[model samples]
Target: MSNTFSSPLAGRSTGDRLILGLAILLSLVMLLPVLWVIAMSLKDNAALMANPNSVFFPPYELTNYLNIFATSSVFRWIANSLIVSVSMTVGVLVLSSLAGYGFARLNFPGRDVLFVIVLFGLAVPEQAVVVARHQIFSLLKWHNTYQGLILPGLSSAFGVFLMTQFFRAIPKELDEAALLDNASRFRIFWKVLLPLTLPAQATLGIFTFLNAWNDYFWPLISATRKEMYTLTVGMASTQTNFAQSEGLGYLMAQAVFAGAPILIVYLFFQKYIVTAVSGAAQR
Candidate 1:
């Protein structure tokens, strides 16, 4: 019995080591551009211009970070990004959970048809709705407000679909148990099932927040005022640039700044993210 196990382990260990090495190599290949960007962001423009190929050893520069801050409202823009992202995440989670539970567990007229319609909604592009959404918001005079930034993204088909799938995976027996205890449907949803949906919630939250944070086009159109600009919009503005003067190093620094929050959020929720994505894939 001992020889049987030892023989297999010896044979497999070499293959396992090879697979692990390849995984590491693939990871590094994927991370190289990001690493280069970090390196360039730390490098001085003159040094980078002189040695265009050299990013590995940096004559580190804080000039870009300082200059951009002095010239632009980068911090305010970051704050705006955070506000929009957090609001969208929270709104999508709440709306998706409620709607998902209704669609997944409840009986209603046209529920199946309505769900199909909602599924079709996933095929609709944001670009297709922008003009209509803009017109409606303009009519409501919400154009420059946080409501303008957040309300349109409160519920997404993707979020609803994800939550619905997650909710379905949970046994109906839990709901039956709650029902026998005189629990209302809402109580069953909130107390018993919602807790189980955390993985889905994390997945939706991260995706929505990243989408909101990285949104450039809608904010560019809606936020006419500089004060209302989100980070992506602010960064893209003609005046806030390495367009002629600040150069590639400065631009890369801005990219790093824009990416930092989402990176932090992803890191914090990474465990939940993996579970959520894997669960969805299995479903």
Candidate 2:
């Protein structure tokens, strides 16, 4: 008994140690840019220009953060970002879940063909449809509105695919059981199926939010009004607000601010995200 149990208490193998070392090394390597940006944000203009690569040798100028809020509309940009990102995420989840479940279960005549069309959309780049989307939005007078920001991104091929595949993975017995209980289709979907899909939903929500949050080109074109500007667009425009001397620190400070939300989100949903991805791939 002692001999058998001793192996369980043994130290990790050398390969495990090596792998752990590599992972830490890789993490540090990835972390360098973030650390550098933080360092830059804490620096003054003269120090930043004098030794751009000589990072961390500092009496850190913590006022860069305060200066940013005083000099620019960072809070407003954050609000706009949250509005667009949250709206788009919710829209994608609701629309995609319904559409995906329909595709997986409904017996409509052109269902497969339509699903194929949505799949084909994955192959099409955003730049390809930018002109058409622009013209249509222009005609609809959606430009510079939240509708302009949120509507175009609501229909996501990846979202539909992820949800459809996730729905299909659920046992048919659950649906049949719900049917025998006299529950309606939407009731089954909302109560029974959706709960099981929380992981996938989290994954899809993260993806959509990050994409919408980081989106710049479409907003740049459609958001003619300053008030409509998302964080990505607003942050880019800040480059011109600062003099060349102060540009580095100013940009770094704003970059950190802009990146904070996504980091918090990722950290929160990381486990669900990993599970969702692995499950989707298996399906």
Candidate 3:
């Protein structure tokens, strides 16, 4: 009896060890790139060229970071990115939530048809219609402007869809109670529904902010002037120059710069993001 019990306990211990080992291996696999980037950023051009395999280790020099800040327009690019992303996030949150509430609670002719048409926007690729959009922007004489970059992404179909789903999940009794208290529909939405739907708003805000923040292709095509270039666009330009010069350190530093702001924002709002996504899913 002692021998049999001991054998089963040993087997379970072995199984647990194997599971822990696999988890550690997976974590290292995910972390490798981040570690590599940091290593590359710290290295100098000479070190990188002399020992290409030494990318896992720190550089003998910190000139790469100084060179990037001094030579590149990275700060300007970051400012532009912030302006566009924040504007788009605010616009999407307000417009999409209002539209969503209307679709969920209001009765109007052709509302369903309009909602269906808007849903179709989600299926359409931004790249496919970019040429036409550029032409329209040109006709409106808004090219290379901040408004031009931001206006196109202002109202997203996905935002509407996400908000609509969340709004539908709200109890009808709340609306009825507000009505009985002589509250206007607008007031009801502003005072009651909006407060209760904070999670959905946070979910939508983060998604919209990320989309606007990291967008590269459209910004590259639309914003021709260096003054209007976003962080991603600026990073792309830096990559091209670094590629030509084989400056691995500079490339990594630029990447870090581009990614740091978004990481900070996410960290700050991470709790809300989790709550919002979980709540939205239940809706």
Candidate 4:
């Protein structure tokens, strides 16, 4: 009986160990690309080209990072990215939240129909409208301008939808109570509802910021001048330059520079994003 019991216990322990090992294996697989990029960023062009397999094992060089910042307009690109992203985030938060609240709470004629039409905007691919958007920008004389880059992404249909859902989740009794206290609808929104929906707002802000920051194709198409280039566009330029020179380290360093800001932002807002996403999922 003791032998029989020991045999079953040992089998179960082995199965648990196997599952754990597989999970760790999967995690390492997912991490490989990021590790490879970091390794490549530290390698010199000669070392990278001569012994590509050995690049992963340190004896690292700092020249790639030093050379990239010294020679490239990386800082300018980062500044442009920050300006556009912050402007876009602020605009989306204010406009989308107001629009969402209006659709959720304030009654007006044809509101539902109008909102349904707005929902269709979310379904439309942005690429499909790029040509028309370019034409409009040209007509308005806004091309290669910060206003041109920032204005187009200021209002997002998905943001409106997200905020509307969160706003609707608030109890109607709270609104009524505020009104009984002689509060205006705007006051109620600012003082009461906004505080309760901080998580959702944070989630929306991060999403909007990330979209604007990492936007490549639109900014590339719209901002024809090098001075107007965002990080994504700048990185593309760096890739072209490095490809001509065959400088793999410099290319990887530029990629790291482009990706770092986004990583930092995500780290800061990750908790709020997870909370808001989980709440939405449950709802």
Query: What is the Cα-based lDDT of residue 78 in candidate 3?
Result: 83
Ranking by TM-score: 1, 2, 4, 3
Worst 10-residue lDDT window for candidate 4 reads 1-10
Every candidate's CA RMSD: 3.8, 3.3, 5.4, 5.4
lDDT of each: 0.86, 0.87, 0.85, 0.87
Candidate 4 ranges beyond 4 A from true positions: 1-25, 241-245
State which candidate, 1 or 4, has the greater TM-score: 1
Tens-digit per-residue lDDT, 157-230, candidate 2 = 99999899889889999999999999999999999998999998999999999999999989999998877889
Q: Candidate 3 or 4, higher TM-score?
A: 4
How well is each residue in 1-283 modelled by candidate 3, as lDDT tens digits? 4454454236567778788778889999999998888778888867788888887664456677787778557789888999999999999999999999999989999999999999999999998899999999999989889999999998699999988888888998999999999999999999999888787888788888888988998898889898889989877776664473587778888777677777888898888889987775665
- Candidate 3 worst ten-residue window by lDDT: 1-10
For residues 131-156, could you state the per-residue lDDT of candidate 1 as single tens digits? 99999999999998999999988859
Task: Look at candidate 3 and give me any clashing residue pairs.
Answer: 43-59
Clashes of each: 0, 0, 1, 0
Q: Which residue pairs in model 4 clash with each other? A: none
lDDT of 3 at 149: 93
